[model samples]
Target: MFEQKATEWVNSYSDMLYRYALPRVSDSDVAKDLVQETFLAAWRNIKTFKGEISEKNWLFTILKNKIIDHYRKAVNRLTDSFPGMADDDPYFEEGGHWAKETQPKEWGVDYNNPIEAKEFYEVLEKCKSKLKEMQNAVFTMKYMEGMESEEICKELNITPSNYWVLLHRAKVQLRACLEKNWFVK
Candidate 1:
């Protein structure tokens, strides 16, 4: 009986689950795999499923954990220093002055227009893809996942000061990228 119900979930929830996972993981194949894994996990844990939360919410929670696990594995794959991060660092020069080329350009974003907002988010995702591994992890955790700073620090095993630095660097890089790409007239 439970197996039949779980199979039905695959038909109904797969599209919604795939859409949610795609943007978060930023890879279609991985997103699809994660959704599949989520369904499998739900099946394995079916005995524990309580009707308290909507089934949709339960599936989403499982997918969220799968995404986090992906990030954790990605973090382990990254080296202590990545080559692109240093060369791509736009915030400061070796002498500690701000980089002139990275100064933010004026963007004519019409926040009231849904179309412009959609465009902005598209560019933002591209910018996010360019972030350093650690910076990407920390930024997504705090902003995308809505995690607290303390929680991010604990999960990523970094100090509070380091978390702030990563977040600041992510913002600066993302802003510069957006200015150059989306804001260009």
Candidate 2:
């Protein structure tokens, strides 16, 4: 009875679980792991889940715990991971709380004007040059490469705290630089 229930639960809830998990983890692999782990955990503890909560609520509660576990493990792994040059490094991982809430979208730049393009690139180049080496790298890795804090931390051999500080400073510097260089026009 327990096996049948667990199997049916998996069939019903796996997709729902993934919908929640994938957005948090961003990587399909990690999302899959989280979903599978959530189910296994639910299977083990399902009996303990009092009738006060519905099965969906209980499963989701378990999923939430699993997500938190991922965050804690990722934090621990990131804290300890250094000289970790693999492309798979968690440095740029997207699941951290520090990850951007808003994804970049097409902000229609009027690119038809050759002079405008040149001027824009020139201003950006000036802004780029003004940043400290680490700031420049972080900004490039973030804005250009679109890496998340987790991956950037791993890639740059820095902690999450360091990553966020660099990003904040980089944004401030770039904004000031752009205002000085470009907004004048």
Top lDDT: which candidate number?
Answer: 1
Off by over 4 Å in 1: 1-4, 82-88, 110-117
User: Model 2 — TM-score against the truth?
Assistant: 0.46
Candidate 1 lDDT trough over 10 residues, lowest sum: 81-90
Per-residue alpha-carbon lDDT of candidate 1 for residues 1-185, written as tens digits (9 for 90 to 100): 86688678988999999988877776689999999999999888978998899999999999989988887777667667532345445578777678787656667766576554677788878888788767887888888889999988777677787778788888888888877877784
Q: What would the per-residue lDDT of candidate 2 be over residues 118-149, giving only the tens digit for each residue?
A: 67776776676666555555666677547687
RMSD of 2: 13.8
TM-score of each: 0.84, 0.46
Which pairs clash in model 1? none
**Candidate 1, 111: how far from true, in Å?**
6.5
